[model samples]
Target: MTAFAEERRADRAADAEQRRIDAAAVDARRIEREKAADERASRLNEQRQTDRVRAREAQARTRAERRAARGEALTPGNVYRKGTLALVTASALGSLPAQVLHFVGISPMLLPLPLAIEGAAWVMAAGVAYADERHLPGWVRWFLRLLVLAAAGFAASINYTYGLHLPGLSAPDRQAAGIGLAAVTLLGPVLFEIRQWVTTLSADTNSPEERARRRHERKRRRQHRSIAQLADRFVSAAPFGQLDFEEAFAHAWEIETGTSTPGMTPRLHQRAARSTAALAQAQRSAVGDSTGRGLFGRLFRRQTESSPIQNPNQDESPQSITNRLGSDLQESAPETPPAGTEPPTPESADPAPAVAPEPVAGPVAEVEPVKSAEPPVLRPVAAVESGPRRATGRVPQSARTPRPTRTPDELLTEARSATADWPDEKLTAEAIRKAVRTSSANGRLLRDALKAERAERAVSEAQAA
Candidate 1:
C-alpha cells in the first residue's frame, strides 16, 4: 500500500509541472504576436509620413516653376532698360581707350576720337530717355539722340585733334582732315535717317484714339481755367477753406485731365460745423459750466488742493484721512441687489443719513458695521432758490449752475462760420468741435442746439424724399 501511494504522488507532481510549462509557452506566443502587430503599425505610420513629405515637396516645386515662368515673361522689358544703361556705361568706358591712344602717340588714324564722342552722346541720350517725354517713341528717341550726339562729337574731336591743316600742312594733318570730312559726310545722312526713323516711330506708336484723347484733355484743361482759378482763390483765403486743399487741388487736377471732380465743399462744411458744435458742447458739459463763468475753476482748485493735510498727531504719523474715509464709506455701504431686481419705488425707498457715523473703538471696529440696512435712495429735492436742472438732472443752484441751452440758430451759425482759415485738405474733427463750442453760449446749450439742428435736417431730408 505504501508503494502505490508513492507512485500516485509522483504522477500528480509531474502533471502539475507540465501545466506550468504549457502556461509559459502560451504567454511567450501572445507576447510575440503583440510585438509583430506593433512593428506593422510603426511601418504604416512611417509610410504615411513619407507620403505627406513628398506631396509637400511636389507642391513647392510647382510654385517655384510658376514664379520662374512669370519672371521670364517680364525679363524682356527689364533687359531693354538694362541695355540702355549699358550703352551709357560703355560710352563712358570708351574714353579710356581714346586717352590711352593719345598718351601712346598712336597713328592719327587709330585715334579713338569717335569712341570718346560716342560715349558722351550716349550719356546725354540716356538722360533724355529717362525723362520719358511724350513726343517721342521711347526706344527710337533714345537711340537717335545717342547716335547723333556720338557722331557729332566724333567729327568735332577728329577735326580738332588732327584734321585741321592751317599754317603747316603735314602729311599726317592732310590724312586726318580727309578722314574727318569723310566721316562727317558719311555720318550726316545716318543722323538724318535716325531722326526720320525716330519721328516715324513716334507717329506709329500713338494710336489715333490716344492722340484724340490727348488733344481733348488739353482743350478741357484750357477751358477749366476759371474753375481752377476759383479753387485756388478759395484755397488762398485767410482761414484755410474747411475743404482739404491738397485733396481738392488733386481732384481739380484730375478734372483737368478729363476726370470728374465731385462737388464736396458744401457737404464738407456742413459736416465740419456739426462736428465742431458737438465737440464744443461736449467740452462745455465736461467743464460743468453753462454760464462759462468759472468754467474751469474747479479743475484748478482740485489740483491746487491735492496736497496732504497736516496731521494733529505728527509723532504717530496719522493715517491718510481721505483713504480711510473712502474705505470706511465703502465698508459702511449696503450691498447692491442682483442686476435683475426691481428698483425700490420713491415711497418705499430708504432715505440716506445726512452725516456719516463716527468710528467705534476695539476689535469690532475692524469689522465695519453697515451704516444703513437698505440701499440709500437719492431724492430730487428742490433748492430754496429755484433754478434750471442740469443735463445731469442736478439742480444748478445747489452747487454749480447748469450750462445754458444751445439754440438752433447758434448750431446753424457754425455752418457758415469761416473755415477759410482751415487747411483745405485737413479739416480735423477737433477743430470743428472747438469752433462749435466757442460759437455756443454754453456747452449744454450747444449740445441742445446741435440735436435740434440734426432733427431739422432729418425732417428736411424726409420731406425731400
Candidate 2:
C-alpha cells in the first residue's frame, strides 16, 4: 500500500510539472505578441512623422516660388539705396556752414534755416544725380547745381539775419557770405568746364568714332520723339469710333521731315492695319442705319428720323421705313422747294415715276424724252446767278483757288501745341524724326490724312460760324 501511495504522489507531481510547462509556453507567446504590436506602433508613428516633415518642406517650397513670382526676392544691389545715402551725406555737409552760423547767433533759434538749407542741398543733389543720368547737357547741370548751392547760402544768410538780431548786418553780411559761397560753388563747375575744354583740346580727345556714335544717338532720340508726337496727334485726332491711319501717317511724316512726306514705313503699315481692324470693331458697335445707307444720306436721315416706339413688340422690326419717312417729311419739308414752284402737270412730267434705286443701277437713268407744247427756255439757276460768272466750260473759282501749304513753323507749332503739357525733358526732336521716317512708306495715306485734317478744320470753322 505504501508503494502504491508513493507512485500516486509521483504521478501527481508529474501532472503538476506538465501544467507549469503549458503556462510558461502560453506566457512566452503573449510576450512575443505584445512586443510585435509595440514595434508596429513605433513604425507607424515614424511613418507619420516622415509624412508631416515632407508636407512642411513642400509648403516652404511653394512659399518661395510665390515670392519669386512676385519679384519680391531679396537682392543685394539697388541704385535707389545708393542715391539715398548720397543725398543724406550731401544734406549733412550742406548744414555745416549754417550750424556754425547758428551757434554764433543769439536771441531767436535758427533751427528752421539750417534744416531748410540742408533740405535744399539734398533736393539739389538728387536733382543733379537725376539730370546726370538723364543725359542733360553738362552746362545745364552745372547751372542747376550752382543755383541750388546759392539757395543754400541764402538760407544760411536768412538764419543769421533773423536769429542773430543784427538787422543791419543782415544785407551786407548776407551779400558777403553769399558771394563767398557762390564763388566756392562756382569753382567746381568752372573747373569742370575748364577741364572738359582742356580735354577736348588735348590729343586724347573724343575719337571720330565716338563723335559719330553721339550723333547717331541724337538722331535716334529725335526720331523717337517725332514718332511719339505723331502717335499722340493721331490719338487726339482720331474719331471716337474710327481709327485715323491716314492722320497717323501724316503726322509721322511731319515728324520725320519738318514737312509732309510721300511715303510710309513697314512699321507704319502694321500700325495702319491694326488701326483699321480697331476701327472695324468700333464700327460694328455703332448702330448703323437700318437701311444700311452711307454717310451723307444716312446722316441726314438719322438727323431727321424720330423715335418710332419705346419697347416695340417683338413682332415689329426695330426700324420702320414708313415711320422714318414720316419723320423725314416733318423735319426736312421746311427746307424743301418753295410752294411757288407748281407740281408738274401730267403732260409735262415723265410718265414713269422715280422708284427706290437698285444698288447696281447707274446714276443716269434712260428715260424717254417727252414732246412739249412750248419750246424749252434757257434759264439760270439761283446757284449760277449768286456766284461769280465763269466761262460755260470753266471750273468754279472755289475749285481753282490753291490751298495753303503747311510751313515748317506751322508743323512745329502744331506739334508743340499737341505736346504742350509734356515735360521738356520728355520731348525730343529725334523721336519726332523717327516717327516721321517710319510712316514715310505710304504716300497716299499721308495725303489722305492731310485732306481729312483740312476737311475737319473746314467743318469746324463752318460750325463755329
Candidate 3:
C-alpha cells in the first residue's frame, strides 16, 4: 500500500509537470505571433507615412513651378529684353555686308555700302524706349525701317560721289559734314519715335481710363447702329402715313437704349425715304390752290403747272364781275378757222352725234356699262343612271371571309385579261396603264406590275411573231 501510494503520487506529479511545459510552449508561440503582428503594423504605418510625404512634396513642387511660370508671364521687362535682343541681332545681320567689305581691302566710300546698320540700331533702341513709354504703332515700326533704308542709300550715294572731300572744304570741315549726316540719319528715327510717344501721351496718358472710355464709346456706337437699322426697317415696311416718323424713331431709340430721347437720330437713308413719302403726300393735298402759298404749295404748283408764269394775261385794272362778260368778249372777237378743218355753218341745224369717248388708262377713269344683246337662260341637268339599282354587286357584304380588294397584281391581271382579245395597238402598255389607272390602288405598284406584264408579253410576242 505504501509503494502503490508513492507510485500514484509520482504519476500525478509527472502529469502536472508535462502540462506546465506544454503551457510554456503555447505562451512562447503567442508572444512570437504578437511580435510579428506589431512588425507588420509598423511596416504598413511607415509605407503610409512615406506616401504622404511624397504626395506633399509633389504638390509643393507643382505649386512652385506654377508660381514661377506666373511670375515670368507677368513681368514686362522680359518682353522688352527679348525685343531688344531681336533688334540687336537684326542690326548685326544688316551690318554684316559692310563688316565683310571692311575685312577685305574694299573701301566703304568706293561702293554703295549699307551705313543704315547704325541708324537701324539707334531706331530699334528708340522704338524699344517708345514701346516702354507707350504702345508703338505698327506703321511707326514700318516707317522706321523705311527711314533706315533711305538713310543707308543716301549715305552710300554721297560717299561714292563726293568721296568725303568737298571743294573748298578742309579735312575737319569734311569730317563735320560726315558727322552731321550721320547725326541726321540716326536722330531722325529717334526724334520721330519721341514725337509719336509724346502724341500718344498727350492723347491718352492714363491707360485704364482710356480703355474704359473707348469701350463705352464702342458700346454706344453699336447701340446707335442697332437703333438706326431698326428705324430704317420701320420706315421701309410702313411708310410715314401708317407710322409717325417721330414716334417710330423714338420707339427704336427706346428699344435699344431704354429711353425715348428725341433728335434727328435716324440714319440718312431712313430720313430720306420718310421725307420723300411726306413730300409726296403734301403735294397731293395741295393741288389747285394758288392762295395757299407755302413751301409745300410751291413744290406742288411747280410740278403741276405747265406754264412758267402764273398769269400771263392779268391786266392792271380789275375786270367787271359779270357771268357773261367772258362770253360777250368772245362774241365781239372775229372768228378764225384752222387751215385743215372747215368752219361750222349756221344753216346746218342738226348737230353731229357726240362720238363715244375712249376710256382713259388710269384707276380713276370712268367705266362704260356693257350692254348685252339677250338675257341669260337657266337649264336643268339630267341625272346620270348607272347599270344596277341594287346597293351591292359581285361581292356580298355579309360573308365569312372579307372581299379581296383590288391590288396592283390583281389590277394588272384584270387589265391584261380585259385587253387580251384586243388588237396589238389596243394591247399596248399605255392602254394597260390607262385601264389599270381606273383602280384606286398605288400608282407605283400598278406601274411595276404593268412593267412585268409588258416584259413577259414582249418576250412571248417576239417568239410568236
Residue pairs of candidate 3 with colliding backbone atoms: none
- Per-residue CA lDDT of candidate 3, range 1-465, in tens? 999999999999999999999999999999999999999999999999999999999999999999999889657745544554555455344333433444233564634334444445456646655654555676766665566556554544443334245468888877765554444434444444444555555557468888888787567557677666787688778954887645666788777655455434335435555565455445345323221123223442453365454332111112221332222222111123234444444343234334532322122222222232222121222223323222121221121122245433345456657765766544554455466544222222333333344444443454443
Cα-lDDT of candidate 1: 0.49
What are the runs in model 3 whose C-alpha is more than 4 Å off? 1-22, 25-42, 45-91, 100-120, 128-465
Quickly count the clashes in candidate 3: 0
List model 2 lDDT by residue over 263-304, tens digit each.
Answer: 565456556666654554354333233212222233323433
Worst 10 residues of 2 by lDDT: 326-335
Using Cα atoms with residue i matched to residue i, what is each candidate's TM-score against the true structure? 0.30, 0.28, 0.25
What lDDT score belongs to each candidate, Candidate 1 first? 0.49, 0.48, 0.49
Best by TM-score: 1
> Which candidate would rank higher by TM-score, 1 or 2?
1
Give candidate 2 regions above 4 Å deviation: 1-14, 33-76, 83-107, 123-149, 153-235, 239-247, 250-465
389 in model 3: Cα distance from truth in Å? Answer: 89
